[model samples]
Target: MSDRDASTPRVILARHGETEWTINGRYTGITELELTPRGEQQVLSTGKLLVGTGKLIDPVQLERVFVSPRRRARKTFELLFGTESELAALNKVEFTEDIAEWGYGAYEGLFGEEIVARRNEQGLDTERPWDIWKDGCEGGESSEQATQRLDSLINRIRDIQRPYMHGEKPVDIVLVAHGHILRAFAKRWLGVPMGSPLAMMLPPGAIGVLSYEEHDINAPAFLVGIALPLEEK
Candidate 1:
């Protein structure tokens, strides 16, 4: 076990706020969509609660940020971190395709009911229904593919954070991306199989925390906390 004073590297996973497709329950993979007015407000509120000094995520401790290439995710990163000048002054931000949402392929823009209907029409088995974790979209990424990409990303993060784990530097990384991809990333962070059931669901603008246990670099990683929107009085 590492010393108690050792700093634990952490990754904060922020899911983008609502889009038209998200609100409508449509599969929005690789589709560019702007945030609704409410979505923008939701992210703004989340930023206030979660980001900055003494907040859930301290800005000074943040080393870098990884963002999905999608517009919604980009907008969320912008809003959460402030204007371009502000973000540039704080941490290095990079847009990565690896962090993009699941490639929905033929299922893109289709609602769950519509996907089921389409499967029935195509003579595909509808008995178990469509679970993205089990039955990946045709012509798109499979569960194994998603797992591989996420694992690769995780490895990169570990490489970046390992040096900081001994308390030489504080490491806090932020990932702004889609709902499905972020949740899957969390599952992989815990070394869980893609085929295993995931009980965690991140709503629009939610923030999930991933960190090492006991501040030991070799310790098992776990989901630390999830920050959700405050209930309106």
Candidate 2:
């Protein structure tokens, strides 16, 4: 085991608040959507929860406040941290494309019930039902495809966080993204199969924390923290 002080950098992932589609149980991907009033409230609650935890971020020590380059996610950031002027003053946050939500492909605008109804109309195996993963939505991304995207994003995060594990630099990351993507991310980070994400459910406006334990600089270490409920303010 590498001998280093206990403070290893970690990631705190937050799901963006509800959007119009989200409120209606539609799968949102690639399409930019705005937050509803309740969504905005959730974002504010998240901000208060974070600040109230007394885990006040040391701006200089944090690497970046990475966020998905999507309107809902970006808006959550804006609401939580304020507008452009404040973000510039904070200086450690940045937007990243890798953290974008799952691409829903043709099913981007469809609700789960709609997809199932379509499946029934087509005489497709309704026994299994329609899921984003497993059976997948026709003309859209399969669970595997979604998993691949999540893996790539998690890999980027690992690349940056590895140095902190080795005591090379103090790097902390916070990601603001979507619910499904965050679930996929947590599973991918644990080296779990993406289908396993079906077992890991989170609500909109939830927070998931990931922590790591170091054994070697390059070896896969322990995931000390997994998904946990945020202070539901």
Candidate 3:
């Protein structure tokens, strides 16, 4: 791990490529849908832009990768890295249920408006439109549950990073999953409340970067953008 530079460790949150459900505004939880034809192209282009030896996410510096087990997520991981056999060589990739898409249960595959209508008919969220962050999904994973699992992942990442952050060996972690969970993960990373109104977006195949502020473990923050660390040939 001696290849690290003076900068702090980084965590890359990558949402999977477009899907039928995503384009149609469906809840898309636990349905195991495939990415659309354009989804594959989207991820390929992203890999070209953001992943490489000197790119934003240099794979050699990656300490660990956490991917959701859903097909769309797996496909994105595969597109970003390689096939299953190729990924085995990296020894840092883990496809886990902990990062799976938020389970919508009865609300799975329903559009937002449709979910709101049904919830209203059921005498739920009657006063206000259904907000997944606030009301959560009926018979599905709750905001608290999302907080618990995401916090566990964040702690695990911190454990891996805390001891080595200042060392010469830099470290990075990658999280590939669906829209809602990744957004929730970002909130949890900063110790934010899961039920807080989230006004962020990570469109398909988009990547968001996160890092500790001022090399302090307690001060996590979003790295929205920065000038490229370019070097002359």
Candidate 4:
């Protein structure tokens, strides 16, 4: 998502690979789970494609890595950078709960259909049903709570990149975490409201990049389908 000598800093968001819960569409938050075997291979492939001396994620440009504390997310980091690879030796990696999946609480293992049924059984309002963006999980985090934590993290990232905005600094960073929280993070990155409906998606094991427009920190925007051009012979 960036050049090794990029003047503009960018944030890379990487979702962990598939787990059993991911396949079953279960609300997996806080509860730790390992990546499926296929998931492992998927991450390995992604690493080869994106991380290298001249790739989208040039290791030399990585200022820091914010990863979920969950095992699955950590495993992805290991695979992406390769446990013994020099790139993996970068010293600023942080395993934090702030980027962890949205805490599912009572809906931790429940599917969407099941959550609605449970809410109905408990005599809760079903007219609007169980829209996580709106209703949120009963015992888990409210949209407000998610916003607070993500906003804090976003501020930190911006602080790191702000001074280096027009300078030649390797200020790019990566976030390794679950799907829901990363998506929420993206929303907050663009100053979008939490309750706003999100059609953007970062599927399991997918990579996304966000950055400022025209090197202006005041105009943060999501970077999509970015491709570096071929050099002339």
Candidate of highest lDDT: 4
Model 3 off-target regions past 4 Å? 1-6, 84-87
Expressed as tens digits, the lDDT of each residue in 90-184 for candidate 2 is: 67777776778877776778887777787788898757755565666677667788777777766777888876674467676778899877877
**lDDT for each residue of candidate 4 in 1-233, tens digit (9 for 90 to 100):** 44333467899999999999999898899888999998988898898888877788877888999999999999999988877746446567888889999988899888888888888899888476567876777888998999999999999999999988875688899999999999999999999988898688887889999988777878898876677533345
Quality of model 3 by C-alpha lDDT? 0.84
Evaluation by TM-score, superior candidate among 2 and 4:
4
Q: Candidate 4: TM-score?
A: 0.92
State, as a TM-score between 0 and 1, how close model 2 is to the true structure: 0.79
What lDDT, from 0 to 1, does candidate 1 have? Answer: 0.84
lDDT of 1 by residue, 1-233 (tens): 53333256888899999999888899999889999999999999999887876566777778889999899999998899887535566547889988999999998998899988888899887577678898888888899999999999999899989887756787789999999999999889888898789798799999887888776666646554444334555
Cα-based lDDT for every prediction: 0.84, 0.71, 0.84, 0.86
Model 3: per-residue Cα lDDT over 165-194, one tens digit each:
665576789999988899999988887798
Best by TM-score: 3
Runs of candidate 1 with Cα error greater than 4 angstroms are 1-6, 85-91, 224-233
Candidate 3 worst ten-residue window by lDDT: 1-10
Instruction: Score candidate 4 by lDDT.
Output: 0.86
Please identify model 2 stretches exceeding 4 Å from their true place: 1-6, 52-58, 85-92, 166-168, 214-233
| Residue pairs whose backbone atoms clash in candidate 3 | 1-169, 4-170
